[model samples]
Target: MWRIVAAVVGLYRMVMDATRELFIRILMGILIFLGYVLLSLFIYAIMRRIMVPQKLHTLPVHLQYTPGCSDIQCPFPQAELILNGGKKLLSSGQYYKILLELEIPETNANQEVGVFMVNLTFHSTDGRYLSSSARPVMIRFKSFLLQILYTLFFAVPLLLGLWEQKQVIELVLFESYYEPYGDGALSALVTVQHHGVQLYSTQLSIEANFSGFTYYLYQWPISMSVIVIISIFVSLCTCTVLMWVSDVVRDYDEQRRAALQRRRMIQARTTGQAAQNGLGTQRRGRGRQQVGSNTALPPALEETTGSEISSEETSTVTGVEDLASEMGRGQSTPPPSITPTEGSVTSSDYSAGFNDVLSSLHTLSRELDGQEVGVANRNIRYRTGH
Candidate 1:
């Protein structure tokens, strides 16, 4: 009986430990998914910043009239051109396409054509202009490769640390079944004794102590390490896949909602007169409320409620009527009158009373048996003899 009790307690502890681990893993998975999403968004933003086009400052055009095309001779023709939003600031070491448009009025179309040479100039924010020969030149900035390399270097350690922490958690929960050896060394250490000669013996360093505690570290077996690595990779992959599935499901749900909305809109449009009369609106509102109420419960709660209903149904099967019947016919009938025998009853009479009590309790508990009935008979006979 004690062994059974101990086993039950141990099983309960294991269940609690497993439950705790499951919750932790679930929370970690959520956090990992969120981190992955944030990282993806950050990378996308960076790529967008790198790839977006940057516009340069516009160049002013100077028109030089020919000798016969003075204001009085040609009345300098009027022209109009519309340009879109102005130039954007450009980063150094970037290449951009340059476009120049010239519009000449029809009135000067027959005028003497002169070779028009225009000089472009670029001015820095510090009031320094580029030399004439350097017009249309490319600007150079520091290379981004070094920055990327440094980022990767930092990220690798951070990722490794996270992986290590995950492995430590797994070790604490699952891989800690084996106790340390007599000398506090892990099981990986091996020792052999042959004829009082110690052979092939290895021990951990014994000098490491901090704050009254000694710390011993050992390398995990290759198989265990590989398993841990694979498990971590698989878990991360699963989380990513789940994230993608959730996104897809969300999008599908949105589409479904949109389709439903469109259908409702179309229905309302088709029944515009009815809707204006207020009957259709009231019907639709009632339907929506019913649907919302039906869907409001979470899936977990739904399952729990379903289980509870099933349990209640099962429990209702053993009703009070059935229990009263099982208690014994004596419960509903009067007890038989016992005749006096020499001013005393035999042991059999006492045993019969004990059996009746046992039977009643057995019916109530549904677990008592003949073994307890025999034990009660023996006790009653022993008392009667004494």
Candidate 2:
């Protein structure tokens, strides 16, 4: 089972690898095709430079001057010698047909004419059917140079755009974080048009439009470093404050726990001491009981005076009552109360003693309640059962 699983995994990996390779190859092929197209265009441009002349031949300058002529003159001569019997008259100005031959190697000085009226005609060398014209006007050699320069300038960026299209695509895909922009072919042509005037009713041949997207990237190390530094500083400060708070809270909790533990220990010790004292009292009581049992006392030879007996009884009861009062008020456990026997104190005396003890306990409870109220007013915290 393990072997089969391993084989399947290996096959999957191989397939994925092959697919990735194919994708990469496709991208590279696109790049190669783009390069080839650019190279071809560049070569074609170079060949055109060699094969086509920098200046085109000046077409034959055909013109007719009416007898009376002015810059704005339009002479209506009578038609006399017409081929179809339409009368015509000789109405002309100084007629000089200067064919502005835009010769390469060297330009003739007369090739430059200014402000003279001129007509244009496009025809074949065989003198076959073509356009006829009888108007003369200004011409300038600089116009030709201007046109050539403009055309060349426009052509450059266009070819460059074509050449770099693949690279541009790749850059856009992979380095999307960078901004890319260019005018491409259209921008080149617009730049060319800006250079010269069109005389022959120009028709633009190429149409190119390019669009690009912009992206942001870190340019300055200082700015990036500053942001990072600020972030780290803020984090460090935040962490420090948190840690300080934690430490303070931890210390406070520990101290509170320790205080509570100490209080409990003291309570425990006091309880144990109270238990021991109670045991000692019990032992003493047992001894006293033994002594009483062993000796037989003679019957009272003479009755004691009523006042003396009363006073004696009163003193004993008072002592017992004082002991009970102390036990009740102390908050800690006290020795158990000893009940007087039939021969001892009366019931009325015992009741009075118990009333005194209860009174004392009520007073202590009031005092504790007052202390609790005071603590609330002061916002003071103290352990209970202290």
Candidate 3:
């Protein structure tokens, strides 16, 4: 029983983990789908909004049956539209064409549409006459739906490729450049004319598209100022962010360079200071070595120095006594000189030669000691043995 329970628990856990993973995957897929759908809808809406051209339209007006409209007679049910309103503009700087649509929605049966005529007149913002276009819409078929479909497919393309629109859009009233900044008004007129004797007297029996068929005009859509402003704003923002980033990078580089330079300076100063300390320690050690060994001379040099000192002492004593005696007796005598010896050193042989000066001082002292002194005295001198 325990084994069965464990197996069931394991199975349950496994199933739960799989279910959780599946749920997560499903949720992610759903989110992605929703995001894609939303983006598509947004793009579609914007495209539709941008693709709608500046248009001039009016409420459909019934064209009263008559002998028909002629240029010599007044056209019936003229449609007028304002260019400055929320509707599509009727301004200049673009090509324009007029199309007439006839409909017989009240009729249950289909009837043939005969020849018709359309007139489009555009006026400037000051109500001044600008341009006019008149064309007899002579083409017709048994099927009104087919006619609408054909025009929808090829109307705008035909207008774009043809330069005949320029013939009607002559005279400048905000011309030379295209901008969504002008205002104007235009009128659409349509006339239903019979073709080669009216076969069917029932005009309402014709099946046609019932919408504003007579007022439709074609014009190319243009982008508004809002899109341009948004683009400029985005560009300025990007440039500002880039400039700020450049400044930050430059400042960082400068600070890093300064830190490296300071570090190098510190290293150089420490190195020089260490070198000076090393030299000072070496000089001090050398000075100590000189001090320690200076007093103890070699055996031969010690004996020589001692003999030189003893010989000088003896000479000084003898010289002083003789000088004293000579002065007392009113006679002068020369000072004694060092005899040549193997171990003795002479004044001329060494750097330290103080014996002569000491002897002179001694002689002077004896003369000053209340003795009549005569001036015939010489300094004791030393001679080294060859």
Candidate 4:
């Protein structure tokens, strides 16, 4: 049995889930229906109250026969009713002020009644109450003073059916807790008795009416409340959907931003790499140019060997010194004879001459081979055949 129950419950859940949208649509439809119903009720109530207003119902048999009703006379044993004001009907579910008057016949033909009873039974089948049938709300009392006495002594209304000597029933405020409509009953019964003998009794079908607050304010309370609750529910759902959409948008934006940032970084890195490559190419080209320059002679160098240039430079400097010295001495005596000899040639000159010769040889060797440049730069030393 438990397994069966579980299976049924699971099936029910599956069905509900499958038809969830249908159920929601049905609920929304019900809410709309209720709203429209309320609107119609509101319009009708306003129009009805204004157009053919309900004539306040009062008692006193005062109408050459009230328009929609027949008057009930005293000591009436048979119930009779005549109603004519059918053009207007009182609204349902409201309060009304009722006034009743009773006459004492001074004496009841050989029987004086010590007490009398009046009962007004009310019933209605209008409201959407749990009971589909007409529900009754009957109020009974002897008189206005006796009704108070009953209310005080019984603490609830003379439910014990106690009768006290009294005359007129005062104006009473009646609240129709149940909704009123056609085919409902408003009965009035009066009984006079003394010493266990009934002297007079009257029963009448009285149509009651009154003036007070309108029913549109509180009509179909349950339906209106349901509509309000549904409205709130729909608002909540809308808010939830909006929040979810916002979250989705926020996530998408974050992802797009991150992707854009990554793309920018990648582009920056690629640009930096390209710049570095270009610089390296420039440097390599410069290096090759430098190497090609070294492999050949330059225009700045003369075709005359570096050795010949050095010798010319030395001889010119020696001649300038000799000329300067002879100018300072006597014109007849030539400058002191200067000859190139082992002792006359200064060690500094010999060293310089050696360095110049080595430099010239280095340049010639490089014209042969571009390797071992410093090693090739050495003073020339000629040795005898060994």
lDDT value, candidate 2, whole model: 0.37
Candidate 1 regions exceeding 4 Å error are 1-6, 50-88, 108-110, 131-386
Q: What is the lDDT of candidate 3?
A: 0.43
RMSDs, each prediction? 40.8, 25.6, 22.1, 25.2
Q: 228-317, model 3: which lDDT tens digit per residue? A: 334544555567689999999999999999999999999999987876665455435323322223221111111111122345645654
Best of the two (1, 3) by TM-score? 3
Q: Write the per-residue lDDT of candidate 1 for residues 1-386, one digit (tens) a residue.
A: 99999999999999999999999999997997677656555554454354433323343333323344434334232211112215323433333333333332212221233222222223333434322211121112223685466457678676777422111000011111111222221111111111111112111111111111011111233453345445555666788799999999999999999999999998988776643445434334323322222221111111111112233433432442354465355554323444546656555654454444434333433421212222222211001111
* Candidate that scores best on lDDT: 3
What does candidate 4's lDDT look like per residue over 1-386, in tens digits? 99999999999999998799788999997987676666655655554455333435543322112233323443322222222234323444433433334422223332333443433333333322221111121223244575556557765334555643333324232333232455543332222212222322222212333333224314454664566455655665577689999999999999999999999999999987876665455435323332222122211222222222344443543443443344335332322334555535444554444344334434433432332222222222222110
Query: CA lDDT, every prediction?
Result: 0.37, 0.37, 0.43, 0.41
* Model 4 misplacement above 4 A: 1-217, 291-386
lDDT minimum window of 10 residues, candidate 2: 165-174
As for lDDT, the candidate ahead, 3 or 4, is: 3
Count of clashes, each model: 0, 21, 1, 8
Question: Please, what are the lDDT tens digits per residue for candidate 2 over residues 46-144?
Answer: 543333222211222122235434333354221111111132111111112222221111133333323333223322223332332333323334566
Best by TM-score: 3
